[model samples]
Target chain A: MNWKRYERASDLNGALTLLDRAEGTGRVIAGGTDLVLQLGQRQKSAELLVDVTGIDELRGLCASGAWIRIGAAVTHREAAASGLLREEAAVLAEGCGMVGSPQIRNIATLMGNVITAQPAADAAVPLTALGAELRVVSAAGERWVPLEEAYRGVGESAIDATREVATEIRFRRPGAGAKTRFFRLARRKALALPVLNGAVCLWRDGDAGRIREARIALGPVAARPFRARQAEACLTSDRITAALLEEAARLAAGEATPRTSLIRGSEEYRRAMIRLYLTRTLWEMLDIG
Target chain B: MDHGVKIRMKVNGQWREAETTPDRLLIDLLREEFGFTGTKKGCGEGECGACTVILNGRPLLACLIPAAKAEGADILTVEGLTPEQGLHPIQQAFQDEGAVQCGYCTPGMVMTAKALIDENPSPTEAEIKRAISGNICRCTGYTKIVAAIVRGAALLRGEAATTPAGVDRERVPQLPPVGPG
Candidate 1:
């Protein structure tokens, strides 16, 4: 409620300029679903709200060569409905489709979810598994930062919203022989935070019929989106087998460090779910019974 | 202190202008400035869809949107659905199907249904449930609300009332008033 001015930026430069002029008191407002709530609770304060939803260059969602770029203004609903994303990055599409609800999805931008930096953010979990990068811009210039490096802590993003704008999220499009899956266990289907959520991206060596690379991401289990490096290492260069899947799932469960949350669940329960969901996701990807 | 910003938006087919503060939520502007009280504010947060309204052809939580964001945009509220004389078909269907219990969630539910039917004229039952998942109806347990949306879709499609057996107008009994006469 302390916001004194609202300015809508027409382009990327304009947005950066507006933020530069605010002298670190201007915050970028895209969807405003999370930022508005934070501002209302006095969790955050801003002298000026530079609305970036109108920035033209920041609204692109297309594939360039090998990368798929999602603009900062791309809402969950738009990402969920994108045919390219559905075909190439279905895990992200599924994650976005499962966010708050249809109404929230229509306005909550993907970058906003990422910037909010909640460990269990639906979109952020999938983006982590996909190894996405953020394109950040400021008056000085622009730089591409890995998605994992963008988080400072729980509910904190490294990118200063008052001074910088996360222009877009870019990730390489999963090529042929690669598959991804996202799994979420929540108290209810909608309007509830996830008890445990995970995402996996696997690339198979077509000729050898072996796993070439794997990325397993889980959340609300750590301070940030957790990458199960041990589990991923176990799966890499390994043949698809029931025993290997079990070992990977177990490793993933071992890697998680979930805390007992009154809203989520007991730590033990979430750990068990990590193993269960990982196993299910791997089995489905490998076409196992 | 900063004074205020001038905003102009098309609300319910009428272009109106208003001076609003930067922090003013769209829901407050709709209710206080435009007198569109039909869009209730059950939960100020986005979890509840009681403040839902269609902005620029998409159904969004008005409580989460800043009034300045609505500048130059087109908005449709529950009040916008009414015709010159009669209730909109969606509202009529809700009444016919007995979807109104405490009547608090009705406006938001109706607006959500309007957006759904506008895009998908023949949405499946699952789609209907998914579309209104954001709306919380403590009364009627959502059975009657779901049935109302189904009937509303039919009415919008220009089909005859295919009221299901459970919500059949004849089958619903009239009860005595709660308060003493």
Candidate 2:
């Protein structure tokens, strides 16, 4: 790659100005794990590299009222190490930890992963399950979108390229008795991208032990990370049982829309593994493990 | 139209100033400009662990970091493991357990292991596996490497000035000299 001008933005306003004045010739880089690869491959262009790692406002995780807010530039490693995130949004933390190896996780940001918009992205599944919302800012103004609605197409998002940048991700705090689990089946154990994955979040209702609500999200089974609404509906207001779990698993597998890849698995095989994970996750969540 | 940037970074415990293209990768800067060849480059795409190094106490892929953005950051490479007296305990353990074969991946492995020990002094086998999961050693099969790290942890704990130290560096295995005497 050829040399390019580099500008380090110390604050959000400064970054906005740089973005505005670059005449659509600049690209914002946070952590640079993904962008560097894209640049090396000549997959993207940016005459002016706006380094955003210096902005302190985009760097922490906190809870406000009933919602947990995470800065866009916060790294996967940071999220994995957070006590508050692990306590409030266990599934999201676990999913972030599984995104890449420790080194990649140390630098790759949560917002960067979402903005990449790959259907098989590990973090998006959990965020979809949590009903996460995003806060996007621009040189012009700001806007908020429910995380699920942010996906306008495959490899495209609702954020405008000319002015907007992801700023925050917010989601409701899970209740005290709630439990979250993330499951995936890939060719190898570590560092390999997910071919298929799922996240499950369930909360119990009082001592009756009935499932008050369940959110099940699957990745690589659709154009975007999708909720298994049929599976969740089967669990609602019902006592945890093996037959119900099996029915839900079958429904989830039937709901998926996996595409054939050049790798080891076929579309049929991917759907089967999705069924296996869904059943096992439900059983484990009910403490039948 | 672009120009090289003059960025100053603290690499291997020393401040270094270099004029690099804006797109220069930190991995190349470490090996080429700083002459710290201990941080290896493998799968420049960051999928491989050969480029692992410690930046500000956190382990990261050097290949994934832009040279210009690393300004004023503390970077520790495998060359920093040994000063003047002797080899680091982790290096010693790898030698005694025969964890190194081709040697191309040793520097990154050692640095990754160092970060793990810094965080968890007495890590279990599972913890050790998790710590080095980012590092791929296709040659040693990871058995000897994991054992070496466990032994190394004990050695590091012993070297501490505290009375209840966890590692004893004196008893660690001895390895050959590392990174240009």
Name the regions of candidate 1 deviating beyond 4 angstroms: B164-181
- Candidate 1 per-residue C-alpha lDDT over A1-289 given as tens digits, one digit per residue, 9 for 90 to 100: 4799889999888888888888988999999999999999999999999999888887889999999999999999999999999899999999999888999999899999999999989999999999999999888888999999989999999999999999999999998788999999998887789999988999987734889899999988999999999999999855678889999999999989998888877888888899998998899898865
> For each candidate, what is the lDDT?
0.90, 0.83
> What does candidate 2's lDDT look like per residue over A1-289, in tens digits?
5438777889888888988998788878887787788777777678878877678988878998988888877998888889997887889889998988998898898887787777777888899999898888887788888878888777776665435668788889997878898888777888887888889999888644899898999988888888999989988865677888888889988887887778737888888888888998889888753
Candidate 2 lDDT for residue A255? 82
RMSD of 2: 4.9
Clashes of 2: 6
Q: What is the alpha-carbon interface RMSD for each candidate?
A: 1.0, 1.4
Record all residue pairs in model 2 with backbone atoms less than 3 Å apart, i.e. clashing: B154-B167, B154-B168, B155-B168, B157-B167, B158-B167, B158-B168
Candidate 2 chain A least-lDDT 10 residues: A156-165
Model 2 DockQ vs. reference:
0.62
RMSD of each: 1.8, 4.9
